[model samples]
Target: MSADGAGGVSRSPVERYTDRMVAALQRLEASDDPNLTFSRLIDVMGRSSHRLLILLFTLLNMLPGPPGFGGTIAWTTFGIALAMIFGWPIRLPALIGDRKLPLSLLIKLSERVAVAARYAARFSRPRLKWLTGAAATIPFGIFVMAISVVMTIPIPFINAIPNVGLCIMSFSMLNRDGVGLLAGLVVCLLGLTVAAAALFGAFELASTAIESIR
Candidate 1:
């Protein structure tokens, strides 16, 4: 799982992060510790790398998992978003942080993410720096927070929509790709619109049912 850095040549952010992710997963796989907690996983993944964390979690949310997995990851992402907004170090509460993860399942999921990240790195490079720079962090955080909330809704097939957008934004930020960032923003907006419409429709349906019953 050790990533070859092409003999230490300069690489795009996506490439660099992909390497880090691969290496981290490798370490987890080789660790002697029987119990791998979420907090440890975060530490192994580099706690200071907020963009990477967001990217990883967003990707995880897109994958199939146990029941309620989507909501759990969405809330974790929400916490990360808040940390980004407040400029605080990322930390999970014990309830989540202490929770044990199935290492085998994580490795499997991470392998998929690594492959996709490598493919994305082929076309991504640092461009439109301002959009991915510090000035945009708060806005991006807020946007991600909104998307994460939408993802928490129990609406079937709804979580995947904004998750794709978030994953793009995260990848864009990691690679400093402003064009990609804008594209991600558009997708997020579209997702949010769909989520809102669905929620409104549900509310209306419930109200009509109540009236009929009365």
Candidate 2:
């Protein structure tokens, strides 16, 4: 319930942050508040690894279908991704970060993520482990940042593609699966291409309309 303890006790590394994330969600279920705030969720989850926090925000933004508060969620994704890139602790702006969310959604999301993570973990291993190393993660950070940008764009159903990409990247990162990371990058690039085409089409249409009006 409280922030992660400060006992300074030694512990082994947990490669997949998803495990910690699942535990955090379960703990939140026991809270009295039906609606959970972002700050509160952090507290409940304790001082977990950065990877876990990033995964949490990214998954919430990647839910398929109509988004509950799409803009808010997208901005939160942006903030978290920026943090990852900058090597800073994740922090959302007060507006998006402090907002309260329905516990039902969080609970459902956590369950679905847990299921997906399990399946993904099976095929993931330490092969090409260098991809996850410190220098390599910078590119990964940029990849995540690009996904966040795509998610924040106000195009219909546009976010869905990148959502899949980010999910793949997230799972791979958690499992330390280098091969998965490569696969994810491919997916992410494909999604970016789609998004770019959509944007170009929209711009051309707008330009045509303006010229016609002239």
Candidate 3:
């Protein structure tokens, strides 16, 4: 319940996010490009935080509700993680940076992302303010990098967890909810632990098989 100087009501943070997300979706739906480039997609979004952009990519990767697009999603998330690590000033790579996405996919993704934004906005309020500030960036960067590594491993279902965590973390950041950020990090850690265990099990199984064959 933000105060408006005039008698009109001001939009809450979540409301603002919902509006922006809806507007972005409409813009994408109207684009003539059969394939929308990343840069162009950002342009359509008008202005957005880095975390929001990263979360959109994550959601798009999961929108089909299946594990696929290993290379594309992995690289995109990786680029975003790099931005987090090096601080916000760094730009994504120009080569794949401008990679294109289908208009149909964007339309589908926009709906899903908007829903998430709306949901997140409902609970988002200023809390645990310390965790969302500049002091927390380095530690958060480390966490982002760790999850980004797991994200690149080409495991579909396994990757979804971390992507979801990142989305939560990003939304929480926007809301300035430190508790939500902490919870999101916990999810990311759990996902990473699961990924690590699976990888280890696979490695051991492969080793035993190779030895038996020899």
Best candidate according to lDDT? 1
In candidate 1, stretches whose alpha carbon ends up further than 4 angstroms from where it belongs are: 1-10
- In model 1, what are the clashing residue pairs, if there are any? none
TM-score winner: 1
Per-residue lDDT for 19 in model 3? 60
- Model 3 residue runs over 4 Å out of place are 1-11, 31-34, 46-48, 65-68, 84-90
Q: Kindly give the number of clashing pairs for every candidate.
A: 0, 0, 0
Q: Per-residue lDDT for 207 in model 1?
A: 100
User: Can you give the lDDT of residue 137 in candidate 3?
Assistant: 65
Per-residue lDDT value at 74 in model 3: 62
Q: Please write out the lDDT profile of model 3 over residues 102-139, one tens digit for every residue.
A: 76767756666667655665676768889987777667
Q: RMSD of candidate 3 to the true fold?
A: 3.2
Ranking by TM-score: 1, 3, 2
Model 1: per-residue Cα lDDT over 150-208, one tens digit each = 88888888666678888898999988999899888888888888888888999999999
Residue 119 in model 2: lDDT:
62
Candidate 2 ranges beyond 4 A from true positions: 1-16, 46-48, 64-68
